[model samples]
Target: MAVADLLALINEVILNWIRLHYFYWANWCGLSTCTTRYLVAMAVADLLALINEVILYWIRLHYFYWSFLAIYPVCSVNDVLRYAATDCSVWFTVAFTFDRFVAICCEKLKTKYCTGKTAAVVLATAGVLFCLKNIPRYFTQKPGTIIDNMPWLCAMVASYYTDPGWVAYDWTDTVLTPLLPFAVILLLNALTVRHIIVASRVRKGLRGESKGENRSDPEMESRRRSMVLLFTISGSFILLWMTVVVDFVYYQITGIGNNLNESQWIFTCVGYLLRNLSCCTNTFIYAVTQSKFREQVKSAVKYPLTSVLRRINKSPS
Candidate 1:
């Protein structure tokens, strides 16, 4: 393998292992909440996506960019799974944001809709929908002769591989995947914040009447926890996804991606890197926010290491 391929392989393998660890640990010993059922689904989808992406990266390294630089009409299993996972991850965040919106903005709907079972159903449905949605993308890859002069034709492949037939679904995916959800999240969070403030003021108004009662209601505490989690999720999603949204919009407006300048190519790479990293960050978010998650991780780590140390000492004696 070339140096580039080796580096790519190492980086991908390391990230995927961490991602898998996060998923395995969180699902196995840490995560246990109705509200976070989406995390379980996200972790599963992320691991599958990351694994397939590593495969695709390996193929691209060996076959397309390395040797067979002249093949056209290329359809790849990698592209299919990549598109599906990318879409699934985006939609899951949207569904989660919608859940938060309802829970904060409308109590009646929250009661009816935002259950663990409901979240599981929504996630399962999203996984199936995205898998079906990107089926068209399976036939979308076609090798194009954009940069026949570059060493590996990196810029051209970036543009051509993304040209998954600019059909209705593509258009919708472009808009709704991150753009619409981003907008809705912003709007909903604004409403949620407003709701929270108003509710706080009302609580103050009732301070005299409820002087005997504790200020921290359990329902209110639950809301606060969910809000914290949502903010963390949304913050990272925005930070990572903003680049993609900008890249897509720039492509739509200027159509200059196929022959991207050096800086634009760099920007594209950074955006994609951020998107790939998004899958790994959620597990960290859970670890940071949930005591249960942290405790489980500590126990998981300590017990194994202690056992290994004990065996080492015993063998030496």
Candidate 2:
């Protein structure tokens, strides 16, 4: 079910990207110029996430044969998948943040700087950085050990308290994965709100421009609404991630409780659900809050069906 959910999310993202670039040119005015780069980055992230889900599913399904499988498998495949997923997520978050930052801050310079070529370079750089950050994990190895009749496939630096390299990995994942992304998003959202407030105030201060006059500018209003929606989406992301972040910190400081307890399992399940839910929630947010996105969806459905009908009508008897 989790794998299915993740795949569905990937599909949603692909559909949204298609709508933004191919169908809703007027709404996503600058998207076509960078569609190739954006799609490539999204594909990389989606593939990594799918791999992670598959590995996790395998682990869960084969838990009964853990003793046999763990010994036969010299390395923990699931851990490797986890590393890949984290790397992909880092790159995806950075790309999304940078895209938003450029769109908002350099609105006037869009044509010059935010082109497909530039986007491609940026995404490629992010991917390289993500891989470099996580490459150490591949070299780290855990001594084979037996636990509860099951061989534990441990990493040499799994415990950060003892391993300097794992400590660095922990800090990097904590900061780059959630902290930095959330910080940048919060700052951008604050600036957007401030800009809107100042504009509103200026409009009110002017002699001829009344509140009604300011409100009448649909373009300005739409931009403001979009920023608000972006902020809400970012807030939701932060909220969903906070659970996992807290769990990480708790494990780092206090460590997991003794015994393989049911409470621990419940917490783990909840954290996993929250993390995956973040990916799924974005589609709902855009669909519900953004008029442009809703319109894009409408066009995506309508245009394709209309084209198909036309082709059928024009077919030879």
Candidate 3:
């Protein structure tokens, strides 16, 4: 069952604007803590995913008025973009997890590893790597049309059964997309937690309560809160990504096609909702959990509206 078009469109708009605003605020404030480039890259990935979703919904629609639409070239292009965006989005989250890991667990190396330049280099590498990885998608998914319940379907012509590379590729993506990232995130978060506990005990054991040391405690607390925010985001990611991974893993291993049974259809619907919902949620998490982020959002929202009002008030009637 497809999501209603109007609701999907509304989701696209809201996700797009809020993320764009967050990006602008992060940049404009020159916030060392928040302006990490991975966040910006993640925003771009989310928008790309949202746009791909809109295009996918449009392509999936089978209207009686346009029964003879030619999809030979377009479907392959759409698949390439969709695959690329999905890959980039997942890898960006992985990069963020690495960022948080270095920041919290490896304090001695944090200055070297967690800088903005380093983040940019990592994000760029991930983008290029995933784009190259999904290049085969463009070549393999030849476009054609098939009739489904009298509605023509823009379909891929690739066959996983005949092509061993296609089968390998599907399995590789399945591992990279969810399994590896989830494992890495869990491992890194655990390490970070252990480091925090050790550091807290050391601080408690210290004899001198210098003014500088006292001030640094708040900074450590702030960093811990940011780590918590990352934790929530990763948890959301795992929740959203698990079902699709399971569905794909099951299909590839068992060669069982989803024939729109009640269970399978429900699985698909939940996957779709989770995938899109995951893209927009980080911004909300930031807003609710990060006080600094909330302040930036207020300024981002206030200045433009205030300027427009001032312009209106000064204009001659």
> Which candidate wins on lDDT?
3
* Model 3 pairs whose backbones collide: none
Clashes of 2: 0
- Stretch of 10 with least lDDT, candidate 3: 62-71
Give the per-residue lDDT digits (tens) of candidate 1, residues 232-284.
88888889888988988887788564678899989888888788788778767
Report the alpha-carbon TM-score of model 1 versus the true structure: 0.71
lDDT tens digits, residue span 1-317, model 2: 75477569866865666555344332453334564355445544544554455444445445633433244243455555566665565446556555655665567886676687887777778777776666566556554676666656554544544567666766877788777887877777777677667766765576467546633666467566657556666777788888877777777677553333787667867876786666556545544565666777788889989999999999998
Which runs in model 2 stand beyond 4 Å of their true positions? 1-32, 35-40, 54-78, 107-111, 141-161, 203-207, 212-215, 255-261, 283-293, 296-317
Runs of candidate 3 exceeding 4 Å displacement: 1-23, 27-30, 33-35, 58-70, 146-153, 207-216, 258-262, 295-317
Give the top-scoring candidate (TM-score).
Answer: 3
Residue pairs with backbone overlap in model 2: none
TM-score of 2: 0.68
- Clash pairs of candidate 1? none
Candidate 1 Cα errors over 4 Å, as ranges: 1-33, 58-75, 143-169, 209-217, 294-317
Per-prediction TM-score: 0.71, 0.68, 0.75
- Candidate 3 per-residue lDDT, tens place, 60-144, comes to 5543324232354555566677778878888898888888888777779888988878887888898998888887776675435
Each prediction's total of clashing residue pairs, residues at least 3 apart in sequence or on different chains, is 0, 0, 0
lDDT of each: 0.70, 0.61, 0.71
